[model samples]
Target: MPWTVMPTFESYAQAREAFSWDLPDEFNPAVDFLRKHEDTSRTALRYETPDGGLETYSFDDLDDRSDRLAAALADFGVDAGDRVGVVVPQKPQNPITHLANWKLGAVSVPLTVLFGRDALQYRLADSEATAVVVDPDVRETVEEIRGECPALEHVIELGTTDAVSGEAHAFEDLLESYEPGIDVYDATPETPTAIMYTSGSTGPPKGVRHSHALWLGRAAAAYNYFDRGLEPGETTVWTPADWAWGAALGGTLFAAWHHGCTVVGWPRDGFDPEDAYDLMARHDVTKAFMPPTALRMLTAVDDPEAQYDLSLETFASAGEPLTSEVVDWVEETFADVAINEFYGQTELNLVVGNSSWYETRPGSMGKPLPGYEVRVLDPETREPLGRGEIGELAVTSDDRRVFFDEYWKLPEKTANKRTEDGWFLTGDLVERDDDGYLWFHSRTDDVILTSGYRVGPMEVEEAILHHSDAEQAGVVGVPDETRGEAIKAYVQPATDDYDPDTLREEIRDLVRDRLAEYEYPQHVAFVDELPTTTTGKIQRRSLRERE
Candidate 1:
């Protein structure tokens, strides 16, 4: 069965009228993908591990494994509407867990392997996950926090079981014991499929709940932004982002599967420019979407085009605003390839972007996609802002084509995101041009964007304050060449006798131990006091301006 609804628009006016979403009453992503693409022998995923091991999973292999896993999970008492936390590296098992969860109507909460015990505990506690799937590397962290999560009943270890303890079950053993051919659950389009967590300014990360139809909504992006009307099974998509992020989950994994394209998943301890270049050449990637930081690093390599045989025809970037220099470098390096920039939050993926059908404006996030109603609104009045005036970017809440269901377990925060009338306010600040292009502005909140990761300033500040030598700390994002924004910290010492060099290392170590590695401040400046308001609240904007 061919896809009944594929967005193919010649112009913006045609896109507005032609784009319509129609999901069946009972929809499962695994069922939908397998049904649409009848060729079960075609490769669905081509994964490369850090140790130079290559693995390929065809559609049939995926279906069988996921069915077995679903059956095994059901035997373990996992039910519909239950949350299953997945903490694993980028591999075939990660996507298997996701499909298995959808097959059983369970919500999969993908947690980054980079997260520490405290960070992991918060999400597990908040989501009340019934079971968690972990790789052997993260098994110890899960075991340490297993006691704190009362709702957690099972810990399924992936890869090796020797390190597992405390009522843990081996993932391989469960799959071997369970029978295949488990029935896929009938889920409504509105049923929650995944609860992806994203960092905010003031509190812990908020879980962005996405419906089962979220995969269908991503087709608008895959067709327009990534592959540009490429035929099914013709394009190969690749990204450096982990499965935990929307870039990899929605953009690379779901989008490719939805379109019947091969997805390349590479797992690495850390990003290396040489490894990235080698993977693209080795995999014959036809289309790729990467963060601005990764793109910049790849462009910085000497004779990048000469170094490898890049098969990329369409390249898209997100996570942060792309600089004009990088844009120029991309054009020069990958001659004749269309390089587009996209803008969207974790809640709603790819709302506004430069599509293949549209003209690329250097430094401007292109017009809103077909199904979304995007606009710039005044932060205070909730009124639409005119072109050239900076305001909060918003999307009409009535349009469910590309919108999040809600923030999981945070009704108050979810309510705060929307206006009384209808618009869902995105905390990002942007301005629009008369031509409908959106221009990037600073974030209204204090969350820092460094190398494609959203780093909460409060989290880093709290970690800095944990150091005995630190009295008070204010964090801000400053312009960076490689990393879209580099985190900078202004620290006030508790005593004048403390050494700045020593305190900096201590502060970095504290954050590295407590939070994700990408969140630690890259630059630390010792100061007597930080700029503050009359109420004693630190003025982060002022600190940003000073930088």
Candidate 2:
């Protein structure tokens, strides 16, 4: 199935001019992807299990399961607009959970398994999630936080429904209880489908509300990013990035499905370079959305090309900036692979990215993507800045395809993101050169971007402060070799009665246990006091400068 609205242009300028969205008055991504691409023999999802076993699933298989799950959910009191948390890995269940929620016109919240109790609690509570579908690994964590989240009721585990008691139910049992197929909710482009959460400089994590139109919004970028594939049927897309993040869910997963391309899923406990190469080779993966961090790690693999018969044609990466060293290495290793790096956040994704159809500037996020008008604006003034001026990158706020609906329930924060006229102010600061390449400078806020994961210093600080011996904690991002930036923490002891060495280890362990494993501070320093503002707030900027 060739893309209907997406343009096939000879040049970048031609693509920009010809590109346009064909979002209809009514749209539902689940129905569009699953129902539109229905085929009995074609594989919709092929997951590589941990034991080196391959699980192939067709669209019919997934559609039937989602339909049954939808009926069960509706019977369980889940109505349209209710929030359902999906906490599974990159299994078929992940997509099934999402489709079932969308069929009900309810919102699906993609919560990553990387998050620990504290990180998980913030998203669940703030979204007022009515139910959570979790795997065995995270079922205990969700149960622990259930008391605090008053709105959360159902706890669906991925085991036998008969094994569960009280509010807890079996995922398989629910589907079996109802027959395959239900009335999918009729929706428009503006119907809210998913609320993905992201950490910020201040307060708890905020849920980014994206409507059904998000899938179509990301279509053009993915089509071009994956080298236009030349043929959709032969295209096999794969990514090690977790499905919960925008990079995987929108960029890799739905993007391929929209064009009727096949997708490969290989979930890993920890990213292994050798294992990644082997998986891709075995599956004959053609297109991938490999993050820069994963690419850098792959460099550690000894003679990958000679050892594995990898068939990658397009390798598109995001999350963090692609370094010149990694870019150079990829070109040398994979001769046929066109390494394209894109830039965007959860609020508005794929607005700016590199493509295989044109010349890519080495250190720049290629020209603003088609259908998105990106401008450099003064951080505080909201005025458009000149070509050479360094300012925050802002996108026109009206494009339903390129912008978020609002920060879920955060009216004031949502209002603060747009100016009087309407431009969603991305906190990222960049400068446009004479050639129109966007060069990143820094962020207006202090949220640390480490290992492509946005680690809010505030979240890490709370984890550090959780320690009994900790007093004040300040966190910042510092330069690192592998990870684009490493998280460093400056801790103040609550009392001199504790030993610095013991306190340092305790702080690290506390953070690791309370948050995502990656968000823990890589570098720790015991301090008498931290640099502070006149208002007595810990100044992360001052700590970053100290590094």
Candidate 3:
């Protein structure tokens, strides 16, 4: 369907002017956000370590440490627009480094600590990153492959360690050596604040850049959506600040700071639901954003009824499509608290979501937020589709003020996908309902075409998962001359059903009963596990690799 809402301020003409919310000339995200809340004496960050120790940082404390770190990074020749690869787990140090880079007007390239040397080297070379902030445990991997990564100039370890190479510097020592204060970079809305690398299953990773305005818009929307009333004093704890998942960490950091609120973080490796619950209860976290997987794990915990009050005003889930079943469970467990789900990607920030003011639909990702336009379009012709028609999802840039400029140094690649018809084709397909809520289907690459019908694997899998015996499922298409391609399902059973043939037939029968006959899997394989990427996205390409 066509976008029902018209742009109030976002237009082609508005693009010439800045899209940012105006602040003082000296304003930088790091200082303006932190210093604005420094005196509140509220816990800015509630942290936990891999070894299960908890720590806290107030806004004032975080500001000081970040400033010192920014100054230290400057000493290592980090400058404006310089790319820095940071591979820290979910800790306060992640945002500290991120904000410090923002203060320096440098592009922060945050990498997941779980990645090995090859992944690290690829990102470093692709981004031409200047320095790396890595965990002490993972430093050896980078060190072993440093010779392969020529663009990487410096290494800063997060914890104190004696395994320093000639090129490595201690993170604590770097912070201690810097003087008290340094000048923060004054970035315009045009300045690129951060470059997030997409986990390209189809190809090499591509860097998606965001301006200060884009990041802040998402944050402000989140705050306003929750009615959190973050008035320069309150704090919010969000866990797992992996750079790939920037919407939760990056968006929360900016949004909390926009209202002068504190941003709390959880421990790196110890991401237990119990620890997260305790940290929130102890620190009194008022706002939070977690992945759907974490939420699922949270529901599985014991004595959730008697656990901490969980007095949070707003709780959200992003990155992956959250199922209605998960949402219902959260609402039931948490006194019907609004478990808001937002939809967006690395290429575009939070584009659509359920807000506090609006009544949320159970399965809907909500409507398009202010300052953006979204539509469902035919994948081939790029023609706008009517409501209830299933097609490719796209967003327009006529309201260009907030849109990304281009993929850095990858012009052909950017143009090949992001189009000039004002539509940036999001590879995912969707079907807009009569009420204007968008229902997410599989990615265009994941949609299985069989017998002249487009079958979304999510639909089939959701039906299959409804069966109690099914624990996990992955669906792909295998070549079939008669039908073009037929649906093939890979399942991991919840029970010890050693007889694959019986379980497979039962699953096929279950699918046939629940879903359309054409949508039922013609073949079922009971495997120990389905191949997945580092971030847990099932690699359908790998399935296609099989016969």
Ranking according to TM-score, highest score first: 2, 1, 3
Q: Give the TM-score of candidate 1.
A: 0.96
Global Cα lDDT for candidate 2: 0.84
- lDDT head-to-head 1 vs 3, winner: 1
Question: Ranking by lDDT, best first?
Answer: 2, 1, 3
Error of 1 at 496 (Å): 3.5
Instruction: Name the regions of candidate 3 deviating beyond 4 angstroms.
Output: 1-27, 38-41, 161-166, 224-231, 240-244, 268-271, 397-401, 446-547
Q: TM-score for each prediction? A: 0.96, 0.97, 0.76
The whole-model lDDT of each prediction reads 0.83, 0.84, 0.69
In candidate 2, position 125 carries an lDDT of 91
lDDT of model 1 at residue 288? Answer: 84
Top model number, TM-score: 2
Query: Which scores higher on TM-score, 1 or 3?
Result: 1
User: How do the residues 1-547 of candidate 1 rate in per-residue lDDT, one tens digit apiece?
Assistant: 1244475567877986666665566678878765568687899888877677888888888888899999989988999999999998788888899899999999999998988777889899889999999987788888888889999999888853565566789888778888789878888778789988888888778888988777777765767787364456777888888888887787768888887778888888877888888888998888888888888888758876688898878788888898888778878777767888888888876788886676788898888887778789888888888989999999762347457889987888888987887777889999999988999898889888888889888888887888888889999999888898898999999999987788888888778777878888889999989999999888998998886
